[model samples]
Target chain A: AQSVTQPDIHITVSEGASLELRCNYSYGATPYLFWYVQSPGQGLQLLLKYFSGDTLVQGIKGFEAEFKRSQSSFNLRKPSVHWSDAAEYFCASKGNTDKLIFGTGTRLQVFP
Target chain B: EPEVTQTPSHQVTQMGQEVILRCVPISNHLYFYWYRQILGQKVEFLVSFYNNEISEKSEIFDDQFSVERPDGSNFTLKIRSTKLEDSAMYFCASSANSGSYNEQFFGPGTRLTVL
Candidate 1:
């Protein structure tokens, strides 16, 4: 079974500071990785995805993630954090069966 | 851009009652999925539908739960004899196809509260 692990349960960053959320996955083959964000009372929004080719994938809201196959990691990063970026972020990986398994998620808190 | 939409933004039902959550997937999407997030937990896939049949389902999707695309655009999940454990945010997602490159678009989600 494919699974995702987000080591950080919560992350805090100051406005304009850099942010990085860790994600790791366990799958037999090359996995389809994705990052999603959910604001309070809103639906989950896709940040970005990685299927093949380039190791670094860019996403909406100035967020990006790098798929490190050797590390089994797809960590999300933002150069500068904004207050609006505070939300729950989830990392997911699609298995060969095409089912997306999600990580426990990291709740980001941005302070001024 | 087209997006998925779910109905009954919030539904509160009594235990043992049946509840149906509806969704209108993207007009051109061919694959539909249902997922749920229990409070403070990760979202778990329940079932995936394509060609009007279930293609994949997780153990979380048991006999008490069923999915149907009764019409052209509507995809619905029905839970029979709901339990308090069923309380969670139920989300509907759709993808253009099963291709690995395609991404699934998620709906706002329906908050189901079983009392």
Candidate 2:
């Protein structure tokens, strides 16, 4: 079975500070990884995705993720996070069975 | 830019009642999907539809749930008996192609509250 794990349940970061959210997955083959953000009461917004080739993939809203196959990790990072960046972050991996398994999610709290 | 859209931003229903959630996927998309997120839990996949038929469905998708593309633009999910556990944000997504790497555009979601 394929599963995604986001270690951080909640994270607080100051505005303009760098941010890194950890994600790990268990899969048998090379997995398709994705990062999504959801504001309170809003639907998910895709951040980035990794299918093949490049380990580092850039996404919308100044977000990026690096896929590490050896570690089974796909971590999301942002050089500088604005206060508006506060939201719930989820890491997901495509399952062969026809669904994307999502992580429990990490609530990002950005402080001034 | 094209995006998926869902009807009924929120629906309050009684237990055992039937509820239908509607979604209008991106016009040019060929695949549609349904997923839900229970409060404080991970988002879970329910089913996927393509070519006017179900391509795949998850274990969470049981006999109680069914999906239909009644028209060219509308994709609907019907729950036969609403349970308290069914209360969650239901999201509709669509992709131009069927692949793990294809981008799936999501809608605002409809919050289903079963009382």
Candidate 3:
């Protein structure tokens, strides 16, 4: 079955530190991958998405993700973390239909 | 900027009662979707709608669950009989089109609590 995996459940980073969250996906065809962030009491916000072409995609809030086909991974990265960036991050892939299959999210906690 | 909007930020209902969650998707979008996140769980897709009909649905969308675009502006999800397990944050989303490149804009979800 097609699925997205987020190996990390929780991650902590001091403010201004570099951050990376891992994601892997299993799909039969070239997949459409996405990264979304959900803050407490807020909706899921799209950070970035990779459909085709360039391996690295830039998204809002200084977030970026690289799609590595060989590794079947699309991991999110940020050069410097902010207190506001602390939220639950989810990795997802569009299924054959319009639905998105999401991984168990990784919660990021930022310390000042 | 245009954004999806949902009514009633939170709803509390007794088990076995019916509840309707309403949403207004981006005005020009053709596709609408409903997803839910149980507390401490991944967001799960429940159903997708387009052109006044359901285009796709997940296993979790059982007979009791139904979606409707009642008019031009409102999309609603109705649970015939709510269960305790139905407690979740229900989200409504829409994209300009169904294309792979179209980003789905999400709305602040409606939190449904069943007792």
lDDT of 3 by residue, A41-75 (tens): 99989999999999999999999999999999999
Each model's lDDT: 0.95, 0.93, 0.95
User: For model 1, how does the per-residue alpha-carbon lDDT over B34-112 read when each residue is reduced to its tens digit?
Assistant: 9999999999999999998999999989999999999998999999999999999999999998967868999999999
lDDT of 2 at A6: 96
Q: Lowest-lDDT window of 10 residues in candidate 2 chain B?
A: B96-105
* Fnat of every candidate, listed in order: 0.78, 0.76, 0.76
Error of 1 at B43 (Å): 0.3
Candidates sorted on lDDT, descending: 1, 3, 2
- Over B51-83, each residue of candidate 3 has an lDDT whose tens digit, in order, gives 999998999999999999999999999999999
Alpha-carbon RMSD to native, per candidate = 0.7, 1.0, 0.8
Clash pairs detected, candidate 3: none
Candidate 1 per-residue lDDT over residues A1-112, each given as its tens digit: 6889999999999999999999999999989999999999989999999999999998999999999999999999999999999999999999776688999999999999
For candidate 1, the docking band is high
Evaluated at residue A91, the lDDT of candidate 2 is 96
Instruction: Name the regions of candidate 1 deviating beyond 4 angstroms.
Output: none
- Badly placed stretches (over 4 Å) of model 2 are none
